[model samples]
Target: MNHSLDGQVAIVTGAARGIGLGIARKLKADGARVAIWDLDVAGCDAQRLGFEADHLQPVDVASYESVERAFGATVEALGRVDILVNNAGINGPVVPSWEYPVDAWQRVLAVDLNSVFYCCRVAIPHMRARGGGRIVNVASIAGKEGVQYISAYSAAKAGVIAFTKSAAKELARDNVLINCVAPAMVETELFREMSDQHIEASKAKIPMGRFLQVDEVGSMVSWIASPACSFTTGFTFDLTGGRATY
Candidate 1:
């Protein structure tokens, strides 16, 4: 139960705000040197949140060059990356699949799915050299069970879940544990993109009948990112408020 990350270094993408920010906060509290990788560093409040001022790295997760460059900078500043949280994502639109914008769909997949791969592709080598590490991709319940109208979001998360599993198997012998959390809904700024009707309907599906709290998700990631989460790799830990019976 000791989710201590003492002496560890963690990189959390999409951390300018919302769930990613919460995860960064938790990691810092648990003793890890945390880096916030996002488009805008100022919005993440790294200093105010008690994170090292030098740990902020501006990055566009959707771009491979940007992610790679930031990774190098993070290493230069924080030394090494021992943990990676692929939490960057977007809920493109509420329209039906038939009516979705091609550009929007592509953008959603790029940020939500491709970026995870991009970051992992870069982090895995370093982790192997260090003999072990943790990678936690923030998935969603929609990935497990396809929702009614949010096709792009659901598909992207599902890919994240699958990628976590595949990548874990490849790194298991090396001791790099990789996993994901399939959350139903977390109250964050991302909610601004969701329609009220979509939010209520999604909440109704959860047996808990409420939106998840960002810190709750953050706590889960903290445990998964720590040495305490050994013996589990390429797995999906449910955080759907009793909604994920599987």
Candidate 2:
């Protein structure tokens, strides 16, 4: 239960607020030095966020060039990267698939799905060279069971799940563990992007009768990212509050 990550360094994307911030706080509490990576870095204060000022990185995870630069900056600032949490994403527009704009679809995939690949592509080599590491991709239950209107978000998350599995297998022998978390609706700022009807419908699907909490996600991810999660790779850990049993 004591998933101590003492002395490790973790990079959590989109950590300026919401779930990313939650995960970063948990990692820091567990003894890992955390680097908060987000586009809105100007709003993050070291004293306010409880992280080192030097470790707050302004990264655009959707861009490979930006990812590479951020990775280098993290290594230079934190000494090394032990864990990479691909948590940056957007809900996109809550419109029907047929009505979904091509531009919106591309942007959603780029941020939600492509960003994961970009981060992993840049971080895996460094982790491999350092002997081993953990990568936890934040996926969604929509990926497993596609949501109605948010086609782009669902498709992007599905790609994340598949990517995590394939990459995990490739790194299994190298001591690098890659996995994903498929969570149901969590009451974050992301809800602002959904309609009132969609919100109620999503909540109704959960047997637990409530949305997930940030701390709940943080706790699960902390365990997954820790050495305590040894022997598990290429797995999709569900945080769906009974909406998903498999």
Candidate 3:
């Protein structure tokens, strides 16, 4: 497939590292001007070393004002936004629903779900004016199937899946496409930060017997955000390494 994104601009949140970084790099390689937004202002500089000018910003997806301000700043810097990848999220804690922390639970939902809404709410208008745009959200397999623990993350991701569908339907008339990817376990710094026993257990559950690569997820995201992904909208593409049968 010819996945060239020439003359396009993409916004990727949580791009200081890991999957978000991978997606930004892929978009740049495909000729799109990329703007990376993350809360880690310090880390972003190191990651922005060789990228083109005016493409990094400190965006706190969990805050409405922050998101709006960041988006505004990004537009001033990158011209327009043609693609948005709502990838900023957190796995709050491994706990049952009954034991979930109120604060942590809300934080997870705010970032994982509300962030998607915030970006779409802000970017859709620009996209409509540009004639069309694409949105590819980073969901998780936990959203599809309830895991033993981590109820907060599972619930938050599930909301992302549903939001993608509903938003796609509303935006389709405007030629904006919204889709999501549900990856089971991926090899990212996020995973490495987890406990070794937990990581091993998660890997053991995957039929592929190994964690998915960040680039693999990036490739899927790039396709969903590209003009090549015309027919599919409000859909979930699996990247569970054979762990998901549905």
The candidate that wins on TM-score is 2
Q: State the lDDT of candidate 1 residue by residue for 1-246, as single tens digits.
A: 768899999999988788998898899888988888888887556356656543888899999999999999999988899999999888999999999999999999999999999999999999999999999999999999999899999999999999999999999899999999999989988788989999999999999888899999999999999888999999999999899989
RMSD of 2: 1.2
1-246 in candidate 3: lDDT tens per residue? 668899888999988788888888888888888888889757555435345524778888988899999999999987889999999988888767898889988998999989989988898888999899999999999999977678888888999999989988888888999999999878877875567777888889899788889889889998888878888999999998888878
Backbone clash count, each prediction separately: 0, 0, 0
The residue-level lDDT of candidate 2 at 159 comes to 100
Worst 10 residues of 2 by lDDT: 45-54
Per-residue lDDT value at 19 in model 3: 85
Ranking by TM-score: 2, 1, 3
Clashing residue pairs in candidate 3 are none
Write model 2 residue lDDT over 55-133, tens digit each, in one string.
8899888899999999998999989999999999999999889999999999999999999999999999999999999
Q: Where does candidate 1 clash, by residue pair?
A: none
Model 3 TM-score, all chains together: 0.94
- Where does candidate 3 stray beyond 4 Å? 43-50
Query: What RMSD does each model have against the real structure?
Result: 1.3, 1.2, 1.7
Give me the runs in candidate 2 sitting further than 4 Å from their true place: 50-54
As for lDDT, the candidate ahead, 2 or 3, is 2
TM-score of each: 0.97, 0.97, 0.94
